[model samples]
Target: MSLTWRISLKSDEAEGPEDYFSSSLGIIFPDDITNQHGDAEHSLIYTSPHLSKSLLIDLADPVKEDDRKLFSHYLWNASLLLAEFVESDSLGVPLDNPRAAQESLSFDVKGLDTLELGAGTALPSIMGGLLGARRVVVTDYPAEPVLKTLRTNVVRNLQPAISPAGSSTTPADSVLVEGHSWGELEDSFSTTHRHSFDRIIVADCLWMPWQHANLHRSIAFFLREAADARCWVVAGFHTGREKMRSFYDADALREVGLEIEHVWERDCNGVERPWDTEREDDVTERKRWLVVAALKWIQIP
Candidate 1:
């Protein structure tokens, strides 16, 4: 595999876009990597369902996997699937992008409230706003640098879709970025904003099973207690030897007053992924699990 990654990061203290991508944020992929059949690794360009221009995402250096900043750097295969799900489900406006839109769950996204947990790079959350969601609040662990990167992506990808409120630092408009650590449910947001989002997107957040209870509670707390409210959860088993052992903590989710409506194991391509990878024809054996479930409000019986 010649897919070696090189990541160049801009300092969070950078003054402006011009100052941001100076020598400090120069392109990582040199000419050498381009020669390799499978090695274009600095950044990935993905076409959006609505945008005419392709979205460019900076990749994370594999060497810096230990760093927290690397979390929002790389573009995951699961993120692509989630993007496709959005493209398919969203109200289709014909765009010049080569990507074809496929229809998924049929629901009008206009004025819908949405929140995405662990919104690394915020591709899905950005899509929600592009699809006409009234308010799309993308959140990740409370790290200024990470939150800044997510906001950068949201602004970069979605310009015509959302208008930035507050200031360049703290955006609170059609699409807002927030720092939300799972477990501290009530502390993440104000009570006035409780049960605010109608739809929740949880992409690539199940890697840490130990935090399943927290993830579940956060989803329950942020998600509106209504029959129509739903959450789309997707995670890939590409890495982490132990993460693939199980999909999600079903018991913990049920404990938090949520129910799993449907679960599908599919490959990077939308085809069904078998339980046993040995049986599947995919040489990569990489698979993603898509779970569609609604938040069940605890009834006082």
Candidate 2:
């Protein structure tokens, strides 16, 4: 009759003085629906505890009123998946469900300097901080309110790591949260980090087919900042598989000067499986495809 959820936090085994840092929000679904698509944009909802008592977020666009509620539901489920990773210890974390595919990925959060684009709730960046990345910068579209919420959530969730006393023992790694759009990336990152990111992580950022060019441009600028920079871009889409063919084609990536070195299947347990071209019809129709693409900046030695 009632929905119940729980949140957990786990420790990491990386280079930081602290062993790990993580948290989870649990949800117990009521026995009402049986056949449901496990999509984050269709299953999760989050409420703010402020006296005003407003919904914390609605990830979908407000213009599409009918779809607004559906997106909220999906965000609620995604929050749960993100909480799980925050609480886990492993570097390559598997997502609990397909809805979580967007937030679930391991990055060198502790020692390596990194940047995360379209951070949504900033879960991936938080995980990076816990993993011991020397510095982790999270950015989203400048016009979106999601960026602010992400900053708030990061501070709230990572309070222990930011404390003055904790800083002495664990050494607080920089977790910079900011508003950044593809249009301003070159200027923004250049001024702040000054060409100093070792790794770049992007998740679920492609979908607006129109923005593909801008996205590619932004990625190129960042990768060019460092000759050895490595980028991992994960995109999750449920609408239609054929729509992505143009975007995922090898030539498109090559045009941006990025060479796809590996294409791996990511299991729920977070292990990378060898590439398999087989397609599942049922899954193709219902769930979005989760793609893990690794790219290295092709700089001639």
Candidate 3:
């Protein structure tokens, strides 16, 4: 049977302004193997116009398999956005680019201790390592399948210099894959890595409202207690604005001693705008917008 159904990424008519989905950072999806059968995984190459190199990722067929395991196996749009943000060299607004407002923040991963919480395919962490971060630790739920795939992707993408835990012979080696379950401060990872990272990357990990407090705990734990340190988060509104909003609530963040330095909603076309709380329920429309934010640990007297 031939596939003829149309897959539309947006609605017939957007209630507000025109859709900005097309203004995405150059994330080119080049191939998908049709000859493969069963549950075999396929490779995806993610490239950006700003990046000198492309990322090779192996996502499980259909991606739903990872969904079953807490969405820890598939490549998400938020991940791509986070990666784009990390890869961007936009120091300040440029008059030459029309989408200049899209990149309102600068997040250079170079020479920094980076950590990614719930890194499924670990795209952002891999990008950080490739872009010359001082150290990049890719972590996820301590599950065998999840950790295995994460390690494979890290090695495949950041090969030659990639070092496994306890095997590093030099400082030149960057990427490290590990198992980390959020809020498990009693665990070895939590104890040893506390106040360890300069930057923490979280993409599309806010869908689970119940895990918000625990997620904050992890962020407060690993994030360095410095003024310049940041936890860069990019979460899609596809899961609904309320669910995403709960995670970034100011009071809630204050409870964990983490404060939002900057937060905004960005359209697919690279336009940065304020969040709209009164918007109607439209998952597709919501998907067209991403909440990008930077949070820092609040110093207490």
By lDDT, who's the top model here? 3
Model 1's alpha-carbon lDDT is 0.56
For model 3, residues 1-301, the per-residue Cα lDDT tens digits are 1010111122343333323332122233212111111122335566544344555676533345544557654566677666656655422213222334434456777678999999988877876776667888888877777787888878777743432222221133556788887888888767888898999999888988888999999999899888788898988777787776678888999988989887777755565677665566464466567778889878831
Candidate 2, residue 169: the lDDT equals 15
Give the TM-score of each candidate. Answer: 0.69, 0.61, 0.76
lDDT per residue, candidate 2, 176-246, as tens digits?
77776674655745465544677776766655666666666666666535555767766543543454445
lDDT tens per residue, model 1, 26-56: 1642222221111113444554424545665
Q: Which stretches of candidate 3 lie over 4 Å from their true place?
A: 1-40, 49-53, 60-67, 90-104, 160-173
| Model 2 worst lDDT run, 10 consecutive residues | 18-27
Where is model 1 more than 4 Å wrong at Cα?
1-43, 58-70, 92-108, 161-172, 188-192, 240-247, 273-283, 287-301
TM-score of 3: 0.76
Q: Alpha carbon lDDT of residue 88, candidate 3?
A: 52
